[model samples]
Target: MNVSLQIRDVPGEVRDAIAALAAANGQSMQGYLLELVRREARVARNRTLFDRLAGKRVRGLVVDDIVTTIRRGRDDPDRADPDVA
Candidate 1:
């Protein structure tokens, strides 16, 4: 399925900038804008999925505990590999 989209009252400078970008990429304005819309939709979908997953919790695991462990690993010289120097 396909549909048409229309944008009303786009400023001249904004339109010109998009036109320049399309030309630089050897694409028509329609093709460039379509790609932009598709990419944004993908990002939005991924963000929604991430938000859903972030709301779930695992037993015996906490975000602050993970952060503290990571900080300790970085700050503790005794924890560093002796051969890395």
Candidate 2:
């Protein structure tokens, strides 16, 4: 379902700026605003999903310590290959 949206009390300069930006991007003002609205909705949906999963943990999965992982990578003994040089 599609419904018309009306925005009131927008300053002239702000409206003109949006129009100019839409023209620069080769889109009508309505299309540009619709795209912006859709992007914002997607961000809100992702935030909701993360909030729902805030403290729940899956079983049987061990998460490694970050510092230890980095140190192990840095201290690798077989880093250099003799064939490369």
lDDT for model 2: 0.88
Candidate 2: worst-modelled 10 consecutive residues by lDDT: 57-66
User: CA lDDT of each candidate?
Assistant: 0.95, 0.88
**TM-score of model 2 relative to the true fold?**
0.65
lDDT of model 1 at residue 58?
Answer: 68
TM-score of each: 0.66, 0.65
Worst 10 residues of 1 by lDDT: 76-85
Model 2 has how many clashing residue pairs? 0
lDDT per residue for candidate 1 within 1-85, as digits (tens), equals 9999999999999999999999999999999999999999999999999999888856788889999999998889788676787
lDDT of 1 at 45: 100
Q: List candidate 2 segments past 4 Å from native.
A: 58-85
lDDT of 2 by residue, 1-85 (tens): 9888889999999999999999999999999999988999999999999988875756654456667877787679877755687
